[model samples]
Target: MPRRPISPQLLARQALALLIGYASARVALWLYLPLPWMLGPMFGCTVAALAGAPISGPNQLRMIVIPIIGVLLGSAITLPVLLSMPGWWPAFLVLAPFLLAALAGSYVVFRRLGGFDRSTAFFSAMPGGLNDAMLLGAAAGGDERRIALAHATRILVVVFLIPLFFSLVYGATGSAGGGNPARNVALSALSLSDWAILTAAAALGYWGGKKLDLPAYAVMGPMIVSGAAHVAGIVHVAPPTQLVNLAQLVIGVVIGCRFLGTTFREVSREMAVAGASAAVMIVIALAFAVPVAAIMQMPATQAFLAFSPGGLAEMSLLALSMGEDLAFVSVMHLTRIALVVAMARPIWRWVARRGEKDGA
Candidate 1:
């Protein structure tokens, strides 16, 4: 099937949204906010959207930017980081239990407090896999709109709060790997050969990952390919800081634009429910993160980012911005999403059957 053509009006809206995002980023930088390029755009676009602006998500642009982020993340995976993977078993071991606890706690909050139906509450309570939850929830006779809104609200709240928490509590700022002056190279610093390698990795990785149907393939594919090249010592430079910041701006805009067509009346109740559920999940995440950090002998922020119920891309970006272990955080989020995708439906089905039996 051929792709549909985008309308000029839609293009105009997208441009306007990007302009707002960029302007917001500059203001945020002037004010010295943490992760200004991202958070600034996110806040600006969200406010615009809620005010009934004709904003549309730059989905096509975001696809292009995602590969850039993937390459940036891949550059963090050095040979020693790859070798240290074995020691992360404890964190990995706790992920399943942590997910279960988050799901159960959130389910209770959604059902009891939010008054959501069983299917809606259960799927809305998922710790990850937003798309999956919406699809499955709709198929299971839940309200699709509610499920989507709940998940979107969860991502927005989690992404917005995590960085602030780190900045305020831990004094961590977003400097792209803790202000590593060496990593702040401009685009002009890259050799032509380096550009070719990076370009090939982004293109080939995206192609291969899509062919294999990997989750979050746009980002994951490039990350894997770039990571391999980095580990092999084939590439010695990261993408330019300017490009990375642009990528962040685009991603923030995409996330905030999710609310474009929503009204406060339509989403107020659902947002409240999802926000409360997100809080429950965050507490559970911290509960697990503290102990896991001790056992893994890493910063608590790293573990928290790994265990947070935020989207894979969002959490990984936070890790990258905060100078945390991007490799570990990305892997853990991949695992969480994969687990939710594989297990949520079967678990929900079992619960449904039990409910049926009890009622009968």
Candidate 2:
């Protein structure tokens, strides 16, 4: 039998349907369900996936991915500078070159992943949510499957390690009694001013995400905007203590879902390689994070979460749980992603040029 090609028009309609469904889910989640933010997207994706809805679309997944890029930019790039600076001017000084090098180095390694080209691999290897990353990868002309796999790998590693890491660092057994409440309650009580700042930061993040053409702008953009707000002394909202646990739950479910139909025997080699790369990335991140945190006089746990290569939501959740600084972690993760994506295209093009010159 010959393969039939799908015309662009039919494809567009399918995509439109998916988008409508996904948007409906997201709005419902935000307004009525009050589930974890992660769950909102997951719910949409799950419905689409289960219904055998074609993944090819101009739907919620793609929209979600765009804002995430902003989140990565905010977390990894902007927040660090804000935290490090004696003033705002000095922050940019540190940010510019750091972003350039990270993107350049990571892209070089990502391209060498055999089947995956630079864009897809870069987005896949990026430290964030799988669905969001895959959507971003697709928008950037990446192999969505590979990106999804890479994200899955990262999530698996984080789920296995974070609890253990927390145990090691905090010297607490895996028990509910380890947490504190009075402090958490105080943190949860967001003031009117704090809400204003959060809203403002979210708006800025969304705008920046759109301008920069990053993925999952809603989550990512808000993170950056809010982070910047905190740094600028416009808001003093900390992570709600309940949100820490909520974040972990979100990550665990999301990561576990990816493994549902996958067989270890089939993906063994790919899994191993992905796991190794992810571990290397995490270690390298930790190396940078510890010293940076020390230099800035930040708590080690907060720094660790800030620096951890776990997905955006996971690390942020951990930060919230430990009563660590969510603003700091959110900014760190956001920046790392933003810089890497921003710089990847130019670096890939340079590599392509160099390859052509060598071939010639």
The candidate maximizing TM-score is: 1
- Which lDDT tens digits does candidate 2 get at residues 1-360? 976777787567445444544464356445533223333334454444435444433333333333432332333334455555453232234444544443344444566654557577567565554555666668767787767766677666664465566667665322231123333434447787765565456567778766877654566656657556656666555444344333333333334345434556666666665676666665665666566666667666666666666666556545544556555666666665566556555655675577578772
**Steric clash pairs (candidate 1):** none
lDDT of 1 at 246: 87
lDDT of 2 at 116: 56
Candidate 1 lDDT over 1-360, as tens digits, reads: 999999999999999999999998888888767677888898899889988898888999999988987898788889999889899999889899999999999999999999998999999999998878988999999898888888888988998888888888888777632223446768898999999999998999899989998878888899899999999999989888888888889988988898878877877887888999999999999999999999878899889999999988778878877777788998888888888888897899898998799892
Best-fitting candidate, scored by lDDT: 1
